[model samples]
Every structure is written in structure tokens, then in C-alpha cells.
Target: MPSLHAIIPAGGAGTRLWPVSRAGHPKFLLDLTGSGRSLLQQTYDRLVPLVGTAGVNVITGARHRDAVVAQLPDLPGDQVVAEPAPRDSMPAIGLMAALIRRRDPDALVASFAADHLIRGEDRFQDAVRQAADVAREGFVTTIGLRPTSPSTAYGYIEAGDALTAAPDAATVLRFVEKPEVDLAREYLRAGTFRWNAGMFVSRADVMLDHLRREQPRLHAGIEEIAAAWGDSDRDAVLERTWPTLTKIAIDHALAEPVAAAGGVAMVRADFGWSDIGDFAAVSGAVHAGETDLGIVGDPRDVAAIDSSGIVVTSGRAVSLLGVDDIVVVDTPDALLVTTRARAQQVKELVDHWRDAGREDLL
Candidate 1:
């Protein structure tokens, strides 16, 4: 296999997992899985095998640059590209692609989010290898997770004809948004849809060419910034030009349109994966081996009596009695109490805090 560079885009507040996940310390920086490593660290660990530490690059917001760097000390300082502000995934990944092309024009770049959990490392690596092989053939490839259930929480990618060049690869027919419960069930029964895990792979030049044709202004701005990347005027050019660039996701800016024009491919990923988007997912992962309750903090700090829910404590002891399917997160400043069913709506609490002028809690 040819040399493949990995780009990790790590920028999200993870408001749904508030109290523990705040603006200054987001989900990617937290050890939500009790594995002694942060989500970003785990992401780096997974990619280091495919592409050596030198081939991996991380793009994050300027505010969290220090934290990201501190967590991944082995990564080269220059590889951590800090954006002046958040312009979503497109600008972040595009900037990394431009920089990679500058260094090696024939480089194959694979972009993955920094906040996700995956079991079965061997399978994951195999899927990425296949995706890279497909991408080298000039197709924008994405790793599509095999749907295990009728999940309404994730978007779906419909697979079309199988590719002759790479048998494991398929033509991506379309990218569908999150559908209703019944529609999700229908999609599950169809056997042609896969969960959109947001894993994209493509050659740096091919990606840049698509961006130039699809989003001309964004393409031009990133090119200008990439041209001045190694020069002393890089910061000056970025500060003046970044804010003026379009703020859109890679899905809308590149993937969807490219798929419609027959330039997208999919690789079936049969490994266990979770974006950990909410407390429900956290609870499930933490309690996968447990009998009833899930405890995130120190186990000795929690005492459960007739309770079967998730409990996260800071320094204080938390006691629960007769509670079922509940979520309790206790931090030094804020505490969250809700049921697992409403875990997806925890972002509303963050919005409420903002409205009530309680920025400190957030």
C-alpha cells in the first residue's frame, strides 16, 4: 500500500454531554470510556498504526490547541494545525488536505473525527485499508458502518453497485439525513443502507480538484492560506482570509454533490463504532460489561440500592435508590439529572444555561 496520511478534525463542544463536557473541555478531551486515555488520544492511537505518528495531522480550534497538544505529546507541534475560529469540518479538513498536498502531492488523505469509539481494531484497520485502495483509484471513499439496528440517530448511506476494481467497495448512491423511526426501520429492512460514520478518504489532489469545482470561493481561500503556510505571513493571511471563507460541513460542501455526480465510493465497516453523541451512548458503553448500573467516576464513590442507571461522580460520593434508567452526572460546578430516554436532549440544558446567563456552568 502507498503512504496514507491521516487527518483528524477535532472541533465540537459536545453540548449533549454537558457538565462533564464543557466549552473549555469538550468530549474529545474527556476520558468518557474510563480507559485512562481521552477520546482524541484514542483516535490518535488508532491512526498511528495505519500512518506513522509523523504522517498524522490534527486540526482543532485555536482555543483548544494547547489541550490537544498536551494530550498527544508525541505528535509534532507543527502537525497540530489550529484554526483561528470554527468554520466546521470542510474548512478544517480542506486546510489539512492543502497542506498535505504541499508536502506530497501524491499523498492519500483519510479524514476521521476525533470523538468516536471503536471496538475490533483489526476490522477497523482492514476497512480503512480497503477504503484507501478505493480512494487511490480516484474515487472519494467513505467507510460506511454496517447498520446493526433501526437507528434514527444516524444518517444513512445507500450503497449502489459493487466496484470491480475493489470488490469490498461500493458506489455510494446517496447520503440521507436522519429519518424518522418508521423510515429508519424501512431502511434497516432494505439491506442496502449503512450508517454514515463520517470517515472520508481521497487523494489530496482529487479532493482539492472537487473543492475547486464545487465550492470555488472556499477552494480559493484555502489555497491562498496553504500557499503561505510555511512563510512568516501565514498567520496574517489566515486571520484576514479565514473569517471571510464559507462556513459549511464537508458533507454538504463536497460529499453529497460529488456522490450525485458519480464520484463517491463506500467501504463496508463491520466493526463496533460509536460517535458517543449523547449520555445514552456513554451509559451503554460504560455499562456494557456491568449487570445494571454504569459508573463513570471512581466505583468506590458510588453506592446503588435498587438502582439500575448510570452515575458519574466527581469527588463526592453519590448514592442512588430505586432509580431506573436515570443519568446523574456530578461535577464540581454543575450536576445533571435525567433519564436515558432524554439523553439526546441534554443540549437543551446547555442552551438554557446560556439563556439564563450562567456561562460559568457551561
Candidate 2:
């Protein structure tokens, strides 16, 4: 696994989790799970064990560079690649791929989000190892989480025939968008669909080649920036050219198109996984207290009597009575109260505040 390096693109604002997750301190930086380690640190922890600190590179916004560096000590400073602006996942990942290609053409790169949570460490490592094996075979491989339910919140990966080289790895037929509940249930019943976890493994040259073919303009810009990455003029090149790169995710820029051409592979994963996109998800992902409530702060600070849901408090006592499936987030500047069912709509609330010119709350 010496040839393996992990890249984490950590730039999302996690607006759906506003107040707790602000633009200044995004979701990846906060300890959403009460594990003391931030999500980014947890992501780092997961990958660092597979590839040492030097082998893990972080691609984050310029604003978060220092914090990311602070969270994970002993990692080479240069490995914390900062972006001038958010051009989406494609450019962030593509830049790392280009950089890795320059250093080790044969290196295998695995991309995982900074905010995702995964359980069952051994199963995750096994899936990654298998995905890496499939990647070395020239396939743009992805780890597809086995569907636990008819979850419309996530996109689906359609697994096709199994590859002979790696029996546990299957040829990906296509990538499906987040479907309606009915369609999701159909996919669940088929058993051939897995939640698209957006985790990918591929050889550095292979990934760049796919990028070069599908998104030549974006690829060229990325290459230009990467060429100057090691030089003093790196900032000038990045500032000038990063804005010109296309704003697209890797799924559209690489995964879907590659999968359509029968060049994508899927490794089944059963490890408990969650992106924790909203408060509803947060309620489920966090460890429940004895009262069966998800508390992000001190459990003693929160008192619940025959109530449920999550309460993220900021050093204030929170009490719940006869409330069910509720979400109460208390911050110094603002507070959020909503139900788990309406959690996905929290981003809309953030937008409302933004439109109202309440940047302080954001």
C-alpha cells in the first residue's frame, strides 16, 4: 500500500447544519459526533491508518487551511493543499491527482469527503484495499455502500457483472441520481443498487486521463496550476486560473461518463456510513444517550422527559417535554428549532437569513 495516497476535499459549508456549522467554521471542523475529534480529523484518522500521515493530502479552502493543519499535527505542511475558491469537487480532486501524477505516476489515489462518518473500520479498510486493487486494473473504482433502506437522500450505483480479477468488485452499470421514494424502493428490492458514497479509488495517471478526456478545459487548467504548485509563482497561477476551471462535481466530470463506457467498478461496503447532511441525519448518526436522545453537547446539560430527537446546545441547559422527533440547536448568536422530518429544509432557513443580510448568524 506504499503506492496509495488519500485525498480529502474539505470545503463544504454544511449550510443545512447552520449555527453549529458556519462558513467560518464549517461542518468538517466541528465535533458533530461528540467524539472530541472533528469530522475532518476523523476522516484523517480513518485514512492515516491506511496511509501514513505523509500519504494523506487535504484539499481545503484557503480560509480553513490553518485550522485543518492545526487539527492534524505531524502531517507535512505542503500536503494541506488550499484552494483559492470553491470550484467544486472536480477541480479539488483533479489538482491532487495531477500533483500525485507528477510525483508518482503509478500511485493510487483514493478520494473521500471530509464530512462523512463511517463505522466498522476493518470493513472499510477491506473495501478500500479491494477498490485499490480494482483501480490498479485500470478501472475508475468506487465503493458503494450496501443499501440499508429505501433512502432517497443518496444517489445509487447500479452494480453489474462481477470482475474476474477481483470477485468482490463488480462492474458498475451506471450511476443513478437520487430517485423518488418509489424508485428508491425498486432499487432496494433489486439488490443491485448501492448508495453512492462518492468514495473513489484510481491510479493517478488513469484518473487524470479520464479527466483529460471528459473535461479537457478543466483538466488543462488543473495541470497548469499543478505545474506551478511547487514553484513560488504557485499562488499567482492558482489565483489566475482556478476561477476559469469549470464548477462541476467528479460524478458528472468523471464517474458517470466513465461508468457509461463500462470503465467504472463498485466495491460493496456494509460499514455504517452517513454524510449527516441535515439535522435529521445528525439525530440518527450521533450516539444516543440513555434517554434515547442525540445530544451533541453535555448530556447533563440536556434534560428530556419522555421526549426524543437531537439537542445541540452551547453551554445552556436545554429541556424537552413531550416532544418527539424534534431538533433544537442553541447557539450564542442564533437558535434553530425544527423537526427531523423538516431537517433537510434547514438550508432554506440559512438562505432566508442570508437574504435578510444576517451574515453574523451564518
Candidate 3:
């Protein structure tokens, strides 16, 4: 029953979902679900009940400012926190704490990733409420998704002992990085494993306290940034300081630390959530029944050429021949031709192209 705010990290370029999704346009902004609303906008709408129009804060890169503003126009333009350099999740987490602390020091924050998909809104909102309560009690609450498959694509969390509220909720024994196929299968069979959905609920004051105690350098940098908070010349401050910040993730800098210290709690979320992290994940959402045209194409103009599998088009000419079990995505400037099984590796391909200095291809 306290003041709540939502901090959304919307800085991903979604290189894995390339061709249709590019550096200029990431996966979160696309209505890949064909739900008439984009992922980020959908998240914003869901968080509005707690964060409201003005209370929602988004941390993003300066390059994506116009795109973010275009979606959340009801929000004050200044509320958008744009990083000058490429700092990792730790800095972004720090940035949100600093900014939100200035406005409401005691505010509880419900942090979310912009690109995730969740069905069953009632269950999702209920889980958030429970997490918020735990945060008010000064515990960092993270949602642990019940793994439906032995997916090596996601990191796994071993459910620990039971809690008062969450009898089924795991204590989050240890955070595992992406595992091998065999280990992932082993975990699925073990039945106590859950995927870390990267959602965090905590108070600005409490998280700042933990960061100061645990990550001193990051704490100092963010503290300085917060002290220099509301000046009109914001771009000047970011350009001077953000590049000096470290490139650590919040999971490494904060969550893992708290997890190691044995103070974090996991809430069981059965809301049918998917990270929608790559092209394959998107395909799973858009692909329909085989006999039903099963593929979603621009009705105005879709002339299939012996294509059996699902092919989605956005008003472009798609000529598919003998393509099956494949998701062919055509964007304004790029194209992604990949099988469903290999969709998770889209980020790796993006990185490969980036390493090759093929930014245009990205």
C-alpha cells in the first residue's frame, strides 16, 4: 500500500531478431505478437496501474530517444534517462535508483525488461503485487518462471526452501548461466528449476543501501550522478561521466551479490511468460495452425509461391519456395532467413557482424 514506480530498461538493439528488427529498431518496439501494440508499449500499459503516466521512467540510449518518446508521449520528456556511453545493466540500475530517489526516496520500484511477453494478465499483476509487498519488507523479490522446457537458451534458477507467502516459491539457491543441452534437460527433469525472468522489485533506498555496501565503486559513481541530478544541462554531465562507468550487469553487481548473501526471495510466476529474445521466440508467437494460412502476411498483398511454413509479411512482396520449418522475416532494409531451431543464436550472429564491422547489416 505504498507509492510504487516502474523503471523499464529499453536499451536493447535486439540483434538476434535482425532484418526485420535492426539497431535503429529493436524487438521491444515491434508488435511481434500482432496484438496491435508493441512490447514496450504493452509493458507501459500494464505498469500504468502502479507507476501511472508520469511515474513511469524508462532508461535508454540517446539514439532511441525519439522512438521511446513517440511511444510514451504522455510521459514527461525529461523523465527519459539517456546514457551517453554503453554502460551495462548495473549503471542503468544505478541511474534509475538515482533519478527515482530524487523524486521519491521511499518509492518501491517494479523493474521490468521491455521485450518480454506475458499471457494471463491477472496472474501477472497478482504476482507483482506479492513481489511489491516483499520489497516493502526490504527483500529484493525476483520472479522465477516455471520452466516448461529444458531450454538452454535461458539461465536457470534452482528453487530453494519455502517461504511464508510463497510456499512453492524457491529461495533461489543459485543463479546458473546458460547451461549445456544435457544439463538443461537434467534441470527440467529435476523439477525444482525455474528460469530467471530478470524482473526485480525493491525500494530505491534499499537498493541504494545494498549497492553502497556491496558495490562501492558503482555506488560512488551513481551517488555523484544523483548529487548532480536535476540540472538543465544534463547532456553535459552524461558525456563527461557515463563513459567512466563500469560495464557490469545488475545480476552480477546486485542480484548475484544478494543471492550469494542469502537475502533474496523468488516468487513463483505462472503467467506464461516468454522473453521473446530472438526470432524463433517471435515465430512461436506469430505462427498459427498449419492449414489456417497459419502464416500471417499482409492481407493487402501476399502471394505465396509454394511455401508451406508460416511466413509473416508487413506489406512487402514475399516469394517463398519449398521453405518449411523456417521463419522468413523481411524488413524495409534487411532480411532474416533462419530455421526455428536456430533462432536463439540471432544475437551471436549480430555480434559476429558487429565484430566484422558490418554495422549496416546489424
Candidate 4:
């Protein structure tokens, strides 16, 4: 097997998890699961065991570079590639792919999101190993999580024929967008559909080849940046060319088109996974469907008489009286009080604050 490298894209503000997940402190930096480690730290913990610290690289925003390094001090300073601005996943992943190619063209690289939470590390590692095997055979491989429910929140992957190189891996027929409840149910019944967790693995050269074919201009920009990566003019080239690249995601720029050409593959994943996209998801992960109130901060600071929702407390004491399904997030500067049903709309609140000139709350 070829030496595998890991690329972790650690962008996104996670506005829906606002009050707790702010622009400065994104969701990736938060410990939503009550676990001691932040999501980014946990992501590093799992991948380091597979690829080692040196093999893992993180592509995050320029603003977050310091925080990301602070969270994972063992990661080499040069390994954290900070983006000049947010252009979405395509540029970040592509730039890292280009960089890895420069280091070793034959290197197998896997991209994973830093904000996602996963359980069953053994199964996850096994799936990555299978995906790597499939990638060696020239297929752009992704680990497709077996859907436990008809989730309308996530995109779906339609698995096609099984690969001969790795029977557990299958060709991806198509990528499906997030569907309505009825359509999601239909996909669930199909059984061929898997949740697209945005996990992709491929030879570094192969990934660049696909990008060069599908997005010539974007490919050129990253290649130029990669050429000057270790040079004194690296920052100059990055700032000059980064913004010119297309603002798109890897799914549209490469995965979808590549799959249409019969070049994409998927490894069936049984491990537990969640993006923790919204406060509702955080509640679900933290509460685990239990009716009791879920506390993310100091439990001693909370006094609930008959509450049945999640509360992320700051330093102050939060007392909930006879409320059900209500979310109370008490930060020092801002307080969010909403029902769990309205958790997804928290982003709207963030936007409202932004528009209202209350940037401090955001």
C-alpha cells in the first residue's frame, strides 16, 4: 500500500450553532459532545493514529490558523495551510492535493471535514483502508456512511457496482442533493443510497488530474501556488491567485462530474457519523434522544425544575422552570432562548444580529 496522507478542511462558521459557535470560534473549535477535545482535535486524534502526525495536513482559513495550531500543537506549523479567504472546499482541498503531489506524486490522500463527529474508529479506519485500495486502482473514492434514518439534512450517494479490487467499495452512480422527507424515505427504501459525508480518497496526482480536466482555471491557480509553496514568494502568489479560483465545492467541481465518467467509488461505512450541523443535531448528539435536559457546560451552574431541552451555560446560573424542548444558551455577551424545533433557524438569528449591528452577539 502507498503511504496515505490526510487533508482536513476546517472552515465554515456553523452559524446555526451560534452563541456557542461564533465566527471567531467556529463549530470545529467547540466541544459539542461534552468530550474534552474539540471537534478539530478529535479529528486529529483519529487520523494521527492512521497516517501519523506528519502525514496529516489541515487547510483552514487565515483567521483560524492560530486557533487550529493552538488546539493541535503537535501538528507542524507548515502542515497547517491557511487560506487567504473562504472559497469553499474545492480550492482548499485542491491546494492541499497540489501541495501533497509536490511532496510525493504517488501519495494517497484522504480529505475529511474537521467539524464532523464519528464513532467506531476501527470501522472508520477499515473503510479508509478499503478506500485507499480502491484509490490505488485510479478511482476517486469516498467513504459512504450507511444511512440509519431517512435524514433530510444530508446529501445521498447512490452506490453502483462493487469494485473487484475491494469488494467493500462500489462505484458511485450519482450524487443526490438533500431531498424532501418523502424523497428521502424513497432513497432509504432503495438501500443503495448512502449518506455523503464528504470523505474522499485518491492518489494526489489523480485528484489534480481530475481538477485539471474539470476546472482548468482553478487548477492553474492552485498549481501556481503550489510551485511557489516553499519559496519566499509563496504568500505573494497565494494572495495574488487564491481569490481568482472558482468558489465551489469539491462535490460539484470534481466528484459529480467524475462519477458521471465512471471514475468515482464509495466504501460502505457502518461507523456512526454526524456533521453536528445545527443546534438540534448538537442536542441529539449530547442528549442521545433522552428526555432529560442536556447540559454542555458546568451542570452545577444549572438548576432545572422541569426543563427538557439543552442548555449551554457560561459562568452564570441558568434556571429553567417547567419549560419543555426549549434551548437556552447563556453566553456572557448573548443569550439564546429557542425551542429545539427552531434550532436550525439559529443562523437566521445570527444574520439578524449582523444586520442589526450587534456584531458583539455574533
Which window of 10 residues has the lowest lDDT sum in candidate 2? 284-293
lDDT of 2 by residue, 151-196 (tens): 8789999999998756589999999999999999999999999999
Which digits, one per residue and each the tens of the lDDT, describe model 4 over residues 1-362?
57999999999999988888998999999998789999999999999988999999999999999999999999999999999999999999999999998888799999999999998999999999999999999999999999998988899999998888786989999999999989999999999999999999999999999999999999999999999998999999999999999999999999999999999999998899998898677777785344478888888998888778888888799999999988898888989999988887888888899999998877
Instruction: For candidate 3, give the lDDT.
Output: 0.78
- lDDT per residue as tens, model 3, 48-111: 8766887788888788878989988888987788877668777887888777888787888878
Tens-digit lDDT string for candidate 1 (246-275) = 999999999999999999999987899988
Runs of candidate 3 with Cα error greater than 4 angstroms are: 165-170, 232-234, 292-300, 303-310, 347-358
Candidate with the larger TM-score of 1 and 4: 1
Q: What TM-score, over all chains together, does every model reach?
A: 0.98, 0.98, 0.92, 0.97
Pairing residues by index, what is the TM-score of model 4? Answer: 0.97
- Candidate 2 Cα misplacement greater than 4 A, ranges: none
Model 2 pairs in collision: none
Q: Please provide the root mean square deviation of candidate 1 (C-alpha atoms, Å).
A: 1.0
Candidate 1: residue 53 lDDT (0-100) = 99
lDDT of each: 0.92, 0.93, 0.78, 0.92
lDDT (Cα, 0-100) at 252 in candidate 4: 98
User: Which regions in candidate 1 have their CA more than 4 angstroms from the true location?
Assistant: 288-290
Q: Report the poorest 10 consecutive residues by lDDT, candidate 1.
A: 283-292
Candidate 1 vs candidate 3: the lDDT winner is 1
Clashing pairs in 4: none
